[model samples]
Target: MQRKKPYLQPYWWRLLFRANGTAAWEAMGRGPLIPVPNAALTRAPLEVWADALLEEAPYELEDLHGDLLLECYAEPAVTDGTPPVYSRQVRLPGK
Candidate 1:
């Protein structure tokens, strides 16, 4: 028996918005990545933080269409050194 690795590792969270919320004007947090062991814990704080930030602005909080999304994908560790699974290949000239 072996410890199996996760196929899709948890990545960044995408906070999407509509209406008056502009994605270009916003910036993601640059602080240390807090290891939240539970997904339930992550949602409340993220939503609260987003709401608090938006509250300071002129946008109507209720009117804003927003969702906190977890972005996950297969990490490099899962793909590295695996044969045809790799996409890029070094081709010899004229071959």
Candidate 2:
């Protein structure tokens, strides 16, 4: 697990599961968080697409494994500013 790039630029996709706010029991993301290209992200309105993806995410968390009570629809990982950088993305109005 120590034989890969040591730095992540953010915006890459990953599978994350948490046991608590503290880093007591956590497995690292299986891949590097490389900076996603503008041609690879989903087009906005990001909220709509995100909600749709969230609808199909795996969120059946068990009480003995995780403790984060986030959204209940799907279980999508939150992205900071990634949806604006995806493929075929149109420019948002008003900058």
Candidate 3:
């Protein structure tokens, strides 16, 4: 009998936010990309990072499809030995 391969899901750009510096550092060490949600009142940390990264990135904003945009955020933490925090935000073309 032939076995079927599992369906692979497409990856979307996520906007993650860490309220505190420590959480941000932890997230960075784990992976370059984080998950986020889209909201009007508040912006997620991941959104800030994504925006900054995209600014330096060569990819055109128009390339990002409407379906791929994701925004996320987390509570900030307090602790020593925390790395410096950076913000990134990605705006779709014709915002």
Candidate 4:
């Protein structure tokens, strides 16, 4: 049987935020595209990171909503040219 490695394929991510009902969106950040094989490992840290970003003062949480896009890639910048494997959008705190 093949043993599972402690670290698995890294998940790539990019976070974008925009005003409510707006077409314009800006890329706020992206996690280091490193291998993290399991989805369980990826979810918590990425979400925590997003929550932290929203808390930062630079962003005016009001009128802002965003989505976290995640894709599993074996290597950095692989661009397998596919849709994100996972995606979720949330409204930032404030109106």
The candidate maximizing TM-score is 4
Q: For candidate 4, write residues 11-92 as lDDT tens digits.
A: 5655566655677766664454544435655556644544454456235444444433333333456453656645456555
TM-score of 2: 0.28
Descending-lDDT candidate ranking: 4, 3, 2, 1
1 or 4, greater by TM-score: 4
List the global CA lDDT of all models: 0.32, 0.35, 0.37, 0.51
lDDT of 1 by residue, 1-95 (tens): 99985343333232222323444323224432223233533555434443444444334333334332222222323232433211211111111
What clash pairs does model 1 have?
none
**Where does candidate 2 stray beyond 4 Å?**
1-11, 20-30, 34-42, 59-95
Per-prediction backbone clash count: 0, 2, 20, 6
Q: How do the candidates rank by TM-score, highest first?
A: 4, 2, 1, 3
lDDT of 2 by residue, 1-95 (tens): 57864342234333334443456423333443433333333343434444444344334332234432212111135354434333221111111
Error of 3 at 63 (Å): 1.6
- Give candidate 1 misplaced runs (Cα > 4 Å): 14-24, 28-60, 63-95
TM-score of each: 0.22, 0.28, 0.21, 0.46
Window of ten residues with lowest summed lDDT in model 3: 20-29
